[model samples]
Target: MTAPAAPEVLRHVDALAEVVGRQHVLVGEQVPARHVQDLWGSDRKGVASVVVCPGTPAEVARVLRLCAEHRQPVVVQGGMTGLVSGGVPGPEEVVLSTERLDSIGEIDPAIATVTAGAGVTLADLQDEAARHGLVVPIDLASKGSATIGGCVATNAGGVNVVGYGMTRQHVRSLQVALADGRLLELSTPLVKDNAGFDLKQLFIGSEGTLGVVTAATLALRQAPRTRTGVFCAVADVAGALELLTAIRAQLPGMLTAFEVVWADAYAVLDGLDLRLPLPMGYPVYVLAEVQGGRPEADSEALLACLASIEHVLLDSAVADTAAELAVFWQARERIPSEILRMQPLFGFDVSVSARDLQDCLERMRAELTERWPQVKLLVFGHLGDDNVHIAVVTGEQTRKRKAEVEHIVYGCVSRSSGSISAEHGIGFEKRPYLGYTRSPEEMELMRSLKALLDPAGILNRGRVLTWGNETDPA
Candidate 1:
């Protein structure tokens, strides 16, 4: 039998064990297999032989240094809720689970900045921020399980993107630990700094290729004193778009989240009995949320905005209280969750111009419906940013079927000039389709950046880039 040649890694793990204790370290089969992958839920090509849980940046850096010394590849993991396959560990690799790093460092109410550990859950951060009377605008459905690191790593955009923007836009600074153990203390809550290269972006949406995110300084918005939500039916995406424009123009104070759901997805909601109180015969549904400091004014503005959308006979259901608002929001949140339950659906998060969105969506919907009329397609998302999440449901869970849906959807994405992956990072799942969104010249730049940062090709191999040699096996 060949014994393990983990002399160097063991030495450092032993040192780390002394500082944080041995219980956190999962070596050999003691490491849980479930921790190896993300939300995608499958056996990874690479499975980490060992998994380590580091509680702080010091420990994270210590592990990275040891991996560097022995030239072993490391995969950083958070929450294991990522739809991409980047978090899946390789057989010889070591998994650095951020489970132990869960901490909300501080909440600066005066400055509206949140300093939180990468391992903190989205819900935890939101709750903490609420305590300080502030809000971190990057709200995703996965808030219950998704971590701060995962959101930043993917530059996540949820329903709020129409108003607040993505995780990248909200992240003021990052605290990243590089492959060579160099701690980049970049959590400087500066609103503007044009001194040089904005290094904070190096790891945002990199899918753990360049380095692991340890902590972040996220910019926060003052918690709205009042928010008015409208669940309304639009004629179609065009009407939805028109409704948003008119509403924003007339009642800008109440335009915080403007989301649209295709009739197909709305039908799914209807089938699942998750429909809003308003009748659901429309071709599209727009869940518009308006927030302002004054509740009374916001509510009245929302009512007035609904009245102005003449093209679409908008039947609106307004959420009067916090509980009512939560119920209304659930109609949107529950769509993705319920659809996910249907045998591994192909979720395509694509973004295009608002005007082009109607044409883009119609073409894709027509193409899919014409081709695989039997296939159930659920489409809904933040129409505010022209972002759509299209989930093509196949009763079959086989890889071939999944690939077929992927090719068809991505072919349209490329043709329509839409992004291949919007909120989800171009992890292993979308690597092949990256060309649809990026040109050869642009791809070359990405490759150049990856090569420069991780010359050894050690950070999360087979992710983001289509071609790259495997890093040193741990």
Candidate 2:
């Protein structure tokens, strides 16, 4: 592979600027520091030579075409709030940002769907849906900054995933730009379509390696009239699972979320300036929510259910008012940012079957403690979905320590037949651990797909799955 000359680089940048307007393109120092870094880790201060903000899919296609012609690698960025280093650009690469393609298009009530631009934030989409008495059920802590395209690309699963499912379930179809700059309108927001194949599913969680998702037709749910929350403490993982089963059986569609935060995680949240419903000291705590009509009655019903299981719960509190409900969720949503407050922290999100989750956690904790005597592990997440978030706070944040911790955690996950990544895609950070989750045949198939969709390997060049010596398959 011959490297592009200085003249070729200049020609590509000039062409990109012309396609997306000079004001929308940034190079070198012009790129903001925030754009240089993702949700975590050190910023790539001067890695990329150019950042292009295309307002429309047509402009995005043209930009990709130009980049392909110049043999210049392009990294696609949405909200820049990704946990993995998937969106981070290399020194020679160009960044294609979807911040300008943020338009909330048609919201068809009849079809129970909404058409939104890739750049539209999750919060914005929720607000729009609220006005029409509909909902884009997928949610996350970074909803304020996380774009629809990023969520769909990563197949994000949030607190409500136990009920509404992940971004993949909510997304009906997608409009994508292929490697050669050709556009493809995959499908529509139709409920029943016995088409030959659902091609849009490939891009939903492919992490931009397959194509650039410019717009999406997402399935919407009816906005529930009432949303009640309950913050309670359970005896152990068994009690937590029992509570989940009971709540699901009783509430049915009403139970929208079931989140579990371990004692260590509660200790972190206890320091925050918020009211703790239950006195903060429990083996495990759950933030359960129900969505239906009659908020007051729903709260009472949830309270009654808790009372019936008083034998299993150590202590509990119910939120009948909206303010109280907000406080309960506030504690859960604050986990990600507050965990960062603990210096030398490493966070992970993995999944295991409910039956094996407890053993997996115990093995992980015991092994981690034996390895790092002074380490602190804060565990929490949507337990109803069998997904848990672990934050490892250790005295040493060295590269070697981090790698060892990863090995221990992912090793346990592999032993339990659990996924290394529950919702977050295996970006470059988790690429090494992919083998623990998937078989060799799976990796080869992924490579084949990458080669077929992005033959030049110019799009997100080294993300999700890296190629040989930065040029071929690893």
Per-residue alpha-carbon lDDT of model 1 for 1-474, expressed as tens digits?
112425444555665576567898777667665675676564344445667888889888888887877777777888877777878775666778887778887777788888889899999999999898988898877788889998888888887887888899888888998888899976468887777788988789888888899998899999888877878886776778778888889876557788778777766566665546566677778788888887587778777777777557567678888888887887877777667667666777788767777666667667777656767777888878878888886555564666666777887777778888888887777787787788989988988988887777777877888544433110
lDDT of 2 at 98: 92
Clashing pairs in 1: 46-89, 46-90, 47-89, 47-90, 47-91, 254-290
Per-prediction TM-score: 0.91, 0.95
Scored against the true structure, residue 142 in model 2 reaches a CA lDDT of 83
- The numbered model that scores best in TM-score is 2
Per residue, candidate 2 scores C-alpha lDDT tens digits across 1-474 of: 122223435557777878988999876667776666786663233255578999999999998888887678888999878777788776677889999889998777777788899999999999999888898898888889999999988998888898888888888789999978999998777777768888999899999999999999898988888888788898799999989988887777788899999998888777668777778678999999999987567777887778777888888878878899898888878777778878677888899998899999889989988978888889998889989989887777564567788888999999999999998787777887888989989989999999999888888877878675743212
2: Cα error in model 1, Å = 20
lDDT of 1 at 4: 49
Best by lDDT: 2
